[model samples]
Target: MMYKKLFLLSGLVLSLILVGCEFTKKTVNNVNLFTIEDDINLGLQVSQEIANDPKQFPILKEKGNEDVYRYIRKITNKILNSGKVVNRNNFKWQVKIIDDIETLNAFATPGGYIYVYTGLIKYLDSEDQLAGVMGHEIAHADQRHSTKQMTKSGALDLLLSAAIGEKEAVKQVVGGIVGLRFSRTHETEADEYSVRYLCGTDYNAAGAAGFFKKIGGAGSPPEFLSTHPNPDNRVQEIEARAKGMGCRGNSTNKTEYNRIKGLL
Candidate 1:
């Protein structure tokens, strides 16, 4: 009986390993363990938990900040509808602008939840720049960077703990996300997605590259810029990506962006 039990347990572990190692055929961000559904549920659970923490919620929250959020949603909706992304139909997309203007940061979770600081919006010069940031973040969400990172960063253990209903494991996953940064390869993949998503839209394909150039030139990297690859390296790659796409004569929408800033 003991020998049979051990065999069954080993088989279960091996099966889980196989599931996690299953690879998709996509050329970008293809390596992942969690199914789209698993990631979506994980993201929703974490987002809800984070939203419940009063200290965790940004000041002003989303209730009185509809205008800023509306502008962000407009950009996100347009990009999402561009049909350039994978797993598009698998998740419900949403975007929010945090009230903090000094943070200069933005991030997206596994599902479709994206958050941008007011500072990134104010710091940028044009709607194209905003699109650049938004597109990059949307790519992060679209590509399931959070889950990829989690899987790479001990999320397998967390998943097991979660299977056993370990609350601390859930907390650890949430806390880990706040400082999560993608690997260079993953960052590049997300950038590629950003460039592609912006191409057919009203925004320029090089918006992301331009934003990287500005941040690099400015010399004071914000938290958003901190975890990314060196701005110079990213800018060069983004330029190359933009050129490969044969994109030209893009709109910057500086006037409209200024108005959005004013709304904030």
Candidate 2:
């Protein structure tokens, strides 16, 4: 009877706590309990691990490789600093060029550390497409998708404490961030933001469709695609979105993209 009473009291306390705190449902942009500082520290730790592994995953830090990185930097930074993105001053936005010339993917870690594989870069036709890819990834970061994912998964209680400043848990956190397969709604939301970000910039939002069309389904889906929407249908939606948003007459800058390819 004593044990039963303790359990009841514990439940009552939890209910009272919830009532006092006014705990609400977790929404796309509103469930954020982790502070911005947590994301920055987490991103920096994971990015450092990726940068150090040269044999398994080469960093594009060889001689005369600076210019291409600069080109990518300019594109990513432009979108990051485009004022279309909220909290522009808080993010530590940096783009890393992974030397994997086979894996056609790019991902953004929390607090705006983006990784672009060389294969995807080579596969894209122009710089505008590159910007589209970057913008999509940045949207994920801006939306704090990882934190929301953890919260929805019910692991935020356990992981939040470890995720902050815990180097040993870096792999787990990084894996969750990179391998997170966002829902269809999440994908659509990011796609919309991709168009918006490209709209205000020099790049055409339609360039996003080109990249999606090129590799709609090259191989089996990875973790990022487990919940991803169909790329073929996504291309059509993106194109229509671009037109609806009046994003015509935007520049692709194929000339500069050609130079970037040549430099690589």
Best candidate per TM-score, number? 2
- Candidate 1 lDDT, tens digit per residue, 1-264? 433442344222432332232233234334566778776776676666567664764734567667766777888887887788776788767666666777677777777777788878888898777787778877877878766654543345564453343666556555655555555556677778888888868678878877777777565554346444778888787778888888773888887788878988
lDDT per residue (tens digit) for residues 130-191 in model 2: 88878888888887666555444444443454456465456555555555666556667778
Best by lDDT: 2
Each candidate's lDDT (Cα)?
0.67, 0.70
Stretches > 4 Å off in candidate 2: 1-30, 222-227
Task: Flag regions of model 1 displaced more than 4 Å.
Answer: 1-30, 59-64, 160-166, 217-228
TM per prediction = 0.81, 0.83
**TM-score, structure 1 vs. true:** 0.81
For all candidates, the clash counts are: 0, 0
